[model samples]
Target chain A: MAASKCTSLSGALTRQLLDSVDSVLFDCDGVIWRGDQAIPRAPEVINSLKKNGKRVFFVTNNSTKTRQMYADKLGKLGFDATADEVFGTAYCSAMYLKNVCKLDGKVYLIGSNAMKQELEEVGIQPVGVGPDPISGVQIDWANVPLDKEVRAVLVGFDEHFSYMKLNRALQYLCNPDCQFVGTNTDTRLPLEGGKAVPGTGCLLRAVETAAQRQAQVVGKPSSFMFECVASQFDLDPQKCLMVGDRLDTDIMLGSNCGMKTLLTLTGVSTVAEAEANLKSECPHRQRMVPDYYVDSIADILPALQA
Target chain B: MAASKCTSLSGALTRQLLDSVDSVLFDCDGVIWRGDQAIPRAPEVINSLKKNGKRVFFVTNNSTKTRQMYADKLGKLGFDATADEVFGTAYCSAMYLKNVCKLDGKVYLIGSNAMKQELEEVGIQPVGVGPDPISGVQIDWANVPLDKEVRAVLVGFDEHFSYMKLNRALQYLCNPDCQFVGTNTDTRLPLEGGKAVPGTGCLLRAVETAAQRQAQVVGKPSSFMFECVASQFDLDPQKCLMVGDRLDTDIMLGSNCGMKTLLTLTGVSTVAEAEANLKSECPHRQRMVPDYYVDSIADILPALQA
Candidate 1:
């Protein structure tokens, strides 16, 4: 393992950092763009990584978008990427059910159709995707129809997340044998104008509190996500670099996988926040602080050119 | 205050316990009935309380039922109850908003029509009652249509609870002055056949997590509900007895309001659970232990007859 030598991420040291890793994993949304518009020079930097023979992968917790959708979005944004190189939670969670849990029965999924498509792509059947609308009274909810074939419950980002879906998920989770898997434990989803909404973690926790069970999160911060990438690409965790905007998820995932972490200030956390986490009494919080931080992912564009 | 000499409630002790408090508050579900059927002689015991000149009040965390609804249910079940004597969180929360918070503005309620009716009874208007359906994309959910007049976010049991409602409630709660109040913090509602459904606590916690704020809960274990009954009936907390099946809500509320607590075996908690709490090192948990435990509320019926 390369011992981190500096807290500062800039200039000639940035070039040395870029040269140190053969593979680079990037977190979408905040690092690359705020929304539709691309972050300044981010695309150029990503393109440069590919040009330099660095294995690049876009790892995101966004379960709403399919791999193909992400690939098309990246292509349109002028980044050198493909569907196989993008590992979204929707896809990885499906792979997790197939590879890790080895689930032979159907999954009671409380998520989007994109998740369903991903599960089907991996030859796994997923039920309860779209709106699980309230058909009867609240009392009827107690006797909610359960599928015996449902051996697992996978929770992700669902725009149509309703009480019916939540109840059904809770019912499925009550079984001790049923595997509980969550796409990510993101508490809040930050939006364009400094506004945020409850993330998948809120729904997962709701069901957890109701059912008294914990879920195995398959998103960043969990080593399972990094393992998915590593085992698939035959990449060594020690030689890979993870660049992300969030400290808890992206940087923590990198650190957990024994990879070097780079924090970009385009999203959720700031340098002061990272410093606080680094100095935190809790070992878990301290583990979340990045080894290095850049003003933006675009800061590496000049270094990559050099 | 009578010093409790024995943990067991029966025979001579039951009569003595009944003679102690002038005001008797009952938790409906477990103590009264498992579901539809009445728990043994619960009705006769309640009726006997009123006949003996004791002020009886039906206190419940269940917010789906309005005061009139609770009264009708009680009447059907053969309890001596009136709309005025029944205080569900729906009614208490509404009262809390009006008399306590002195809320003059509209409430953004994520509950049922029962909650709306209760809020209206107290001359407080409530909006966003049913579903806050999402018409746009998930990202559009960040900028949900907000009502500036909404000074409070009162959450209760709504069957039509959705992500849209959760987001809107969270948006309303983002305002520091916007009072957040939950009907109850019950994690799950157990049914007759060992089945259960996610309770309002899940929804309230989800919103609380997303908004990064704490709600002023008005349910049992909270003194606000007791104050609602106390201020209205001109009763002293010391002269009241709280009878409940659940130790966390009912017995805890009794302890909180400086009243005697009686735990009945017909509900969620057991005598063993109460003993564990009584022996717990945590003072809060210890306070939740009941002053007495009855095999059934019906035990008091025999005492009433004697």
Candidate 2:
């Protein structure tokens, strides 16, 4: 089976692979959708999977949206997904702090309003959302008032990410006891027409550089995202099929969780890159090799129908 | 000499060390002054070094202030310093672009007014200084109007560092032909009373992560800085003494240039830290160990008087 890694999914093999898993985990961007538009036949593939008694879930590293927001977007896109069936970094990071770290204090958040809502939903108070414009001078910034209750620094997708916010996070993180967590490490968020904006990873890198500390990431490729889903739904990793367009995040997450991994070609990575990873001598790159790949998620529609 | 590293400099040893060097380079922040206040007896040390026929220069990683601004600050603090004697990243970065890269077009700058002034001083045009607040959406950012004339993306100390600025840099850097340069890699700007703020390195790291490329650094430890000083002054590296507070930047820069190195305790590093570097088996750590350690730059006052 190891020797047959990164094989193309088609005809009989697609059905055989689908039958082996009781659940299918789909990465939101690129796998099932790109930006605001859904991928062709992605909805049918996901809907048919659920109709066949296979549970479907949307797992994404994007931290800008809450579970409910994802569910709303999914429903609008005809994915038939509920808020309970959605797992994004915003929700997963909240779960990681609540369940894994068992954090009792407030979080100094460098993220979005959706993240704030998600953290609040999990009974974790998050401070420092929205625009934190620079004021005074370097001395004022270094001595910026910090919340005594902030026991952790949470970094995610922030449009208003500024030097002041970076400084604030550094001040909080300077306390050795203060926990540091990041949503993901995806450097750029690819948009339509091959354009890309700096992703949460860029912001996270800046904060990590400033704090001089590594963040406990709670996004794709970190077992925590899979664990967040498994703990809630009692998922068997062996009976789950992880589908994503990015080999580094989605396929790597699948590989990390001991799940059957499928790479859809509607997004970031390509077949040549996957083959290169499979042929690589490095252990880390080898893990990024998916079990199977398709031109797009729509390729799985015929398999689901059969 | 290889066996004796990080020795305490005082008494007759200080005079002997002074006699060995015809030129002395001082790091501004912790070695000469802390924030707005000049270190006690620091001015005397610089003046005395000049009085004894040894050339004096200030080399700093700080990119926020222009050479004139630094000279004004030095004059206000009672130091006999001139604008031409300063070798800050702002000025050195301009020199790097004009001389080394030989940039023929305008620069997309992610830095301060000081950097802009320095670039202009070197007959180079610079764009994108001051506040570049976020507008529209992510797609708008990725498609932000790029100046076709921009041949390079230069990053330095930006108090206005934001996600938008980071995005703009990524867009310019997406063009492989566009050169990338960073002023320094200093992560934190240590302030008075043990407080600190995020430095240009944090901003540079964020852009590097987003652009998926390494930047050509123009600051300390990168021999370009020493070369910039040596070219105009015709310095002999062996006859120059480099004194600074931080071992990683200042002392390492001296070592890289084959100059006599002195680590002053009144700044970011300590004698204990220098000792640890000396004991380390790593070649990189060995280079960080200074030839001598001092309580402060003021300790050289007695040697100058003698």
Candidate 3:
């Protein structure tokens, strides 16, 4: 299809869009809250969507937080969300590898315990392969033996990562059949004080360039994440609306999966910036322009009522 | 020509190869000492080459260390060297921007004091644009107000980098005429106590990908670094033998500049690994084949005497 032109949807048109969608996927970071504080009218818009019989699901590429943690944060922000109503990249990554990739082999995971637990819950065993692990062999940089059985490489944000771990991971990726997977490609992670180190995306790119291989990213921007969500919730992509702040991840995810994406100016990107980027020749530019633009979630109530 | 089929050269052949070379360039990190520990017999091999009436220069992509620092390290490791004998990426980068690119205007330098000093020496005024500058303009991340006066973007290793710094760099690169220059592309830097962090190369790749613009890398692997050395020392590329452990940076530099490359099995890459990479279908694979493969620098002493 040709690039979708930006149409200034009237109040009537906004109401039509709101009423037509059966499922609404909300990006947690920018759409709901800016860091910790809730964005203006976030709770009201979400409550209104729920009242109108919409299945509200909080979806995020931030693998640092678990579903329960997201639910707790949402409940505290007055959005009235349950643990089951939230989905994250960690969840989708585990599901994709289990279902689509059909990878039942040994996986060298490089994330938190939450990622490990999620993989286990899906009948897949997760093993840490850097220095210390429970079951599988750990490739200690101080003493890297170069194990031959390592079949796959899975990466996420691990604060305890060492050079030896990275070197061993590169060795594993050197093998042709070894699959490379990542939970998400978020460059920056939100910290309590300020933004800390970038996520696994940076490291993944290094390995990808060195090995000359493209990794199968199972997070946002990958249709697999949305497919997993739709399969679990029984929601049709055509009738779903994805609300997000970041253009690369959340917005691209919605567009790639054939879902309507609403760009909120409250998070990582602004409308003017998005418009300028849309004019650029970036491959992901066309996939970024959202179906609708809004200043904040509070504007959603009036548009839905109209 | 014809991929230089004679790999394992005899003693007389090695002497002939050395005699044919007027100058020799070596990469410091993987080629010589990898973070203080000299590769076995590297110093001896270099000394032997010097005794054979060949001018030897240390050309490295390591921008973090200045020429004086390299000289000190080499001196301690039994290789008699002075500051003039060593050429770093910082030196070549400054030369390229000043002479080739003709960037005489103000530059926002994203590196250390050594790099800044080099740029200033080359008549390019260094300006700080990041949030915290020890002695330059504070880098403004959100809105990089780049006027027409800005000539180039000089990137190096900065430990105290922020997202805003990267964002501003991208903004500067967005300008069609703005020259994007990087000191090197080494992904990680070796730290004290066996630790490593993302280096300037990692940051450079991020900006390069976002801007969709290739950076003119002034460090190792680039023929520009070798060109700077050859011009400064009045040497010829055809008579020069570039000796380094890593094939990508050292060997590629020699190959691109029409010099003989020697691959050692001491640092980051192994002999088997380099052979596999040399035979790969990758475009970089055809750069330079090692004229000779040996376990350490000690192997070169006998050949030089013969």
Candidate 4:
């Protein structure tokens, strides 16, 4: 039912509306914390949802941090969350490579140890540098040598990267038949101290220019992460609520997957900025629009009740 | 003074004919080799200059290589050149810091080792990570622990670089009194195999955005290099000849410094391109017209002897 009739309702009405959601998906990073600082009412919102019997899950395109790590961060921030409540790009990447790519060869890994572990859990052998002594095509570069038998290039962020590695990746991509796959093309990664750093997007662009090839990005905006989420929770897309701060990611993902989207301005975006952007010409203009806009979780209660 | 009049001289005979200069300064990268491969007719023209008793020197904004290195590369390419014939940005950079800025603090070298050697020779101490106890502003990280007691920020090409170093440099630059300097702003550097890589210009931009500050470029367009050339060689500007492939750099530098300029079509700029650009409105419009335009150095001989 439309909750607009409950304009004068208080926290009780907000809880009642949240209880109606069978599945709730929250975007990590901005939605939870601006880098590492928790939003003012994030814990209260999560706790309220839990008390009202809502199934909550944290979703993120950040392949750097593991699911357990996200849960631990949330737990420390006064929000109770478990590993099962977290879903990350690393998990989705592994699933895509295993089910979609049909793995019979050694995989090259460019992300953190968590991604490597996730890939191995799916029965895919992970390699970094080398001539895969025995291989069909190289999947990612963990320790993989440039001259190694690379059949495909997989991209992710690696802090210890060099131009030499980028050059080799370009050389590999020069092969017409070789494929280029990126986990995601996120431009910035949240660092420890509220600072952001250039992520895989920068590296991907370097390779793209050098190779004169485009990569098939497999996470977020691709609908693959949502599909993974649906399958993991065994829920229909229409019944899920997607909550995030960024319109391009959260709202677009939800809209594309046929789910309801809510945009919070407490993260990277503000309501005024989103409104201004809505007036601009954007390619994804029609595909994504937030069903609700709130300044923070505290504001969310009034909006939900209204 | 303008050599014997030829049938080629059709219009504007009333214009004063200035005596031609004997010494010629040629820019290396764009003027001769576009990275690793020599532009068409570049070697032949350079060789012809020597045969015609025209004193020639290769001046480059690239601080990565030493004079001997440039000499070796030119010799391998069938061009006869001594170490003394090559002058790089490193020399001018060190000269500026030592004489103009009067900077005596330990510099955190951020360019090539050759640049470090040049700074050290100029009595500017180099400090960075690994064993060296550093205190002062980071002058460059072309080489890394880019973090130090940097009182100034100096930028140059360092292929093995990360955003972390750039971020730290930006932090140093946040101090209003801290000096920011760059060796050059060439967007792309030529690779050995016709490929291009992001050069120091890209690095400088990253820091510029982070610090919201513009850097004092010390190479090419700065006029400092040209001033150094004029004083060191004891040559009058009106009697000096600047020959380069790019009109924006070589020719513009010449015009700005009151020297005669020659633009060759064999390098970065083509005759058609120059014609098109000449029609545009620019701040340097008066300086746009070259004193001479020729297909190559081979063409210069006939024109000079006319």
* Stretches of candidate 4 exceeding 4 Å from the true structure: A1-22, A33-55, A68-85, A95-109, A120-126, A129-145, A181-241, A245-306, B1-23, B29-55, B67-87, B92-107, B120-126, B129-149, B159-167, B170-306
lDDT of 4 by residue, B102-140 (tens): 885766556667777778878887544221222222222
Clashing pairs in 1: none
Of the candidates numbered 1 and 3, which has the greater lDDT value? 1
Pick by TM-score: which candidate is best? 2
> In terms of DockQ, which candidate is stronger, 1 or 2?
2
- How do the residues A1-306 of candidate 3 rate in per-residue lDDT, one tens digit apiece? 114544444467678788778999998877888767888778988888888889999888776667777788888988878988888877777777778778857677767677777777787776663233212212233234545555678777554343334555655776778888887777654433332334567556645554456788888888887887798889898899998888888888988998988887777777776787678888678788887887777777787554
Winner by DockQ between candidate 4 and candidate 3: 3
Query: After superposition on all CA atoms, how large is the RMSD of candidate 4?
Result: 8.1
Per-residue alpha-carbon lDDT of candidate 3 for residues B176-256, written as tens digits (9 for 90 to 100): 888889898887554435344445676676556545578888887877888788888888788888888777788778778
When summed lDDT is taken over every stretch of 10 residues in candidate 1 chain B, the lowest stretch is: B1-10
Q: Pick the candidate with the highest DockQ.
A: 2
Question: Candidate 2 chain A vs. true chain A: TM-score?
Answer: 0.98
Q: Against the true structure, whose lDDT is highest?
A: 2
- Mark the 10 consecutive residues where model 4 chain A has the least summed lDDT: A130-139
DockQ, Cα level, model 3: 0.11
Which digits, one per residue and each the tens of the lDDT, describe model 2 over residues A1-306?
435899998998988888888999999899888888889988888898889999999899999999999999999999888999999999999999998889989999999999999999999999999888898988888888999999999999999999999999999999999999999999999998888999999999999999999999999999988988898899999999999999999999999899999998889999999999988999999999999999998887887776
- The best-first sequence of candidates by DockQ reads 2, 1, 3, 4
The runs of at least 3 residues in candidate 2 whose Cα sits more than 4 Å from the true structure, single-residue gaps closed, are A1-3, B1-3
